[model samples]
Target chain A: MTIRYPNGKLYTPHTSVQKTEKKSKSKDLSFSNRGKTLEDEINEANDYYIKRRLAIIHKKPVPVQIVKVEYPSRSAAVIREAYFRTPSTTDYNGVWNGHYIDFDAKETASKTSFPLKNIHEHQMTHMQQVTEQNGVAFIIVRFSAFERYFIVPYEVLQKAWQAMENGNRKSIPFSTIEEEAYEIPTSYYPRIDYLPIIQQLIVEKCCGFESEEK
Target chain B: MTIRYPNGKLYTPHTSVQKTEKKSKSKDLSFSNRGKTLEDEINEANDYYIKRRLAIIHKKPVPVQIVKVEYPSRSAAVIREAYFRTPSTTDYNGVWNGHYIDFDAKETASKTSFPLKNIHEHQMTHMQQVTEQNGVAFIIVRFSAFERYFIVPYEVLQKAWQAMENGNRKSIPFSTIEEEAYEIPTSYYPRIDYLPIIQQLIVEKCCGFESEEK
Candidate 1:
């Protein structure tokens, strides 16, 4: 079967399957039936947040090093030759209510627990440094199978990391996380509605339990 | 006169002057006195700072939306076609003493001042949002010709934006910026030691001058 590009006419049998598959994909898309990828949903949610002037969170731009440029005319400069560079932080970062907020979102199919291995060493180090500098660092983990979400604090992840290093399980037990971190209630209003957890974190910080997990 | 692809080889009856130019360029290509390009120098500085655990700054990845992929083998995926995406933030971001630092480095040939047109409206807005969220937002303005530098605070630039709104000057005057912003001295070690300015900002913020920056 020959596949055709979306820009091209999909007259081939292979292209029809993908079109048919995308049509039925709406029902199986997300926890709330949002027909979009996780990145798309988050970007939309971020836009929603930004429009209301609620918070100024944004996904950063990718870095590029232009090796060669083509000046087709004075009107345009095209980077004909360019290279990619490694990213240092989570996919998203910004500020909320006079607090620096940094987070990474990950989705896992496992129903039981999210894998600790999904977090990278460099990212882990980054979170640690953020917390040290007084920024709020978190991981928004979606257990896609269960449609459950949890805002895992950097410290909680660090503790679990230590445990993992000591020959403990490679995943955080659901019970420990439930007892410590805030379980974000998924809703249609804000979709993620993570700001409430940030509010709680702020309150706790003001109360002098700044470093406490919960 | 003509210049072609692969390596831009200039063949011209323009002059033997072109010959001297190529020879001088090849001679200067050796790492004796003059070093790497601006991007390379910044990368080196980033590495220098990161090794000391001083900062987590990194250039963002090049944005490429892959359209067509060729899988010669199941294990190997090659992106055959892609389109670049516009960058949202400056090149570098990281955790600096708990402040989420976001900034872009830019240079121009103009001897008087850098052009405001070099920055996009979206980028300016993004930086403002970062400031409202309490992150340190600024730009590294390099007058590369003179080898002079200044860290232009987001607020200062924002004011310039507002001024332009009222039919005032479109660009911030070089004299005004040189007087207002902290002038960074070029050095032999670590190259761009922007940490000094950051330290000053930290000290000021720590000294109960937080609300005033707004």
Candidate 2:
């Protein structure tokens, strides 16, 4: 019978036990990610900044499978069969100047209310851990209608998530968000001028909040 | 022909067409991990520290194959034929106190030099990236001979890795390590007295560093 390896390679299963079909629910990420999903832009900006010693940030690569690889020699290896692997956290994380930066970029269709279901349990759990460690753990909430961005702390997200778990709100109120979050201004060069908000957050939330930019 | 999926599940080949496994000459990890190695201890320790909130650290769970899973219900799924996936980074990362922490732990029977071969290119790349972000990245090098532990920073590791790459040294110089690394004093509570080194790092390295400990 035709079988598949974990890397999505087609294989003929031989003398093995039987199991079920392969149909796992894939996360439905919108392909029309608004002008370079926040991840790509952040990575690019991180690259740009790090080279100049302005700041260092990085988006972790999408995890992948390497099945049926060819080691031409001890030094070189080629992947013959491979597949995409799911990530538990939103991509971007690294250091900004000196602050430990941890965040996820999410897109939402709704104009007024952002859906709590859009964020996964795993990402939330990961964010919680990041925050406990004194990292700048936040989410870049993109409300497409407003064409705006807000840097929402994980603590706020957790409270919002807990509220949802308690069936208090299926969505975080934009008013509450407006009050708590710093509105990120968009720009042409970096696309997301999050550093300004980050500066604000450093001033307000980060320990010994000081502006090194000036 | 009793064909099975990688998950060792039974499958029926499609009648219309067939896809064959793309072949390769590389070694299979499943075969290598068969002997019940102690490689999992670091992963376990990371989990323990994370759960206790003593530190916000974790070993990224190795990815796996889920060719066939039984969903007794829509909410629950049981994996049948899964194999451990390779990881890009060393087994641990998180926040200690208020500092970003990243590390890999390795043990060697060698009395003197720990082989650089234990650290992979991918792991080095991960360390490099973390360092760029100003994160305190390092490795927990364990000399099983005297049962000693040392927290070697990424800078030291990078230099050692380069030397190994240049074939100048097969392993890091023990003297260089003794001079630079913070020897992890053993303890009864956490087993690794990591806080002292962290304290040193904060005083010496982190920008706008704060004394957060009680």
Candidate 3:
């Protein structure tokens, strides 16, 4: 049997480990590196930002609900039974440049459209609430097949999500995302570098710079 | 044998359980309620605030480093070996009323002073960074023995922490805390009700009302 770890790595029982390894290899066949995912890139970027004192963004630890525990020694307690919990908010949030930044990083394998199922309803609801509170909220979408990353603002995401709910399309077409999202060009030290894009969005939103930028 | 859970609950092993049960009873001799702790009170307060859309604060999950896993079925995977990890940031953080809120909730059994050991160095460093970023950072200290809670601003906490680092008193004297911290009166729906105190502090900090308040 194959089990997926919370970090998205697959673990296989020793009996059929080879089979599981083959599946994981195939899953990573398209990307540049097998172990690195969009989440990893963003985490590295956050580390870079923190090192330079640019931001304090962090990925919230995965929540778990424990049902049973065992005491092996005086100082050691082991969780015997537990289950992963649904997060109440987006994966990442913090303060950057005296502004609240909240966002989630998601990657899709599809070449043409990003599946709506990739994002949960509760996450979208959280983004909406954060934005309503005057916080900067967005989604970092990576089309893994194309090796492209885009920062889609909460407004754009809301439009796309509502369109899906209204039975317009099940997935956000890649063309729509390309048109509406800001392409975050890759960098070396800070791999994802989404903060500048976030700042730009905030400036435009606050100053009504659509016409000025045009 | 008995084990203490992360939330401070005692877990007696099933073997020789009768003997272990007696110990737990004796340990709960002082508190008003054996089941409810300060963390529970703060969590309830956060829930109340969230439901009313007043704030979006959340406690970060306890971090655990998984060392081993077992797969009994296709979908069920159990962590067989894991250890608790030291958190890099304070537990609770979010956006509230167009401001970034970052804080940690700590309870001390001592009636006179809060031991510096109650908070980790990394957590205090994280709070310092948050404050430097213009985010509101504070700590909610509960003297559990007296059933008292106070909202201590980062400035107050920093002074105590630095004093300890400079070979001064190892604890923040209760008198000092009582003088510097805002006493948070308990409530029904929101048991800890610390956000109002946070707002007041922010108002004072921004408007330079320290002298006016005195």
lDDT of 2 at A131: 76
lDDT tens per residue, model 1, A117-189: 8899878987887777677888887655455567888988999899899999899877776687787765554
* lDDT (tens digit, per residue) of candidate 3 on B38-98: 6677787888888788888889998877767778877877776766778999999988866
Clashes of each: 6, 8, 0
Model 1: lDDT of residue B203: 70
| lDDT, residue A167, model 3 | 82
Q: Give per-residue lDDT, candidate 3, residue B1.
A: 27
Full-model lDDT for every candidate: 0.67, 0.63, 0.77
lDDT of 3 by residue, A12-58 (tens): 32322122222332434333443456777888889988888888999
For residues A112-206, what per-residue lDDT tens digits would candidate 2 score against the true structure?
A: 66688878888998787777777788888766556566888887888889988887988888887777767775555465667767767866774
Candidate 2 residues lying further than 4 Å off, grouped into runs, are: A1-35, A61-90, A207-214, B1-39, B60-91, B106-110, B115-134, B144-148, B158-170, B184-214
Model 2 TM: 0.63
Per-model chain A TM: 0.75, 0.72, 0.81
**Model 1 clash tally, residue pairs:** 6
Best-to-worst TM-score order: 3, 1, 2
After superposition, the stretches of candidate 1 with alpha carbons farther than 4 Å from their true spots are A1-32, A61-86, A210-214, B1-35, B74-76, B202-214
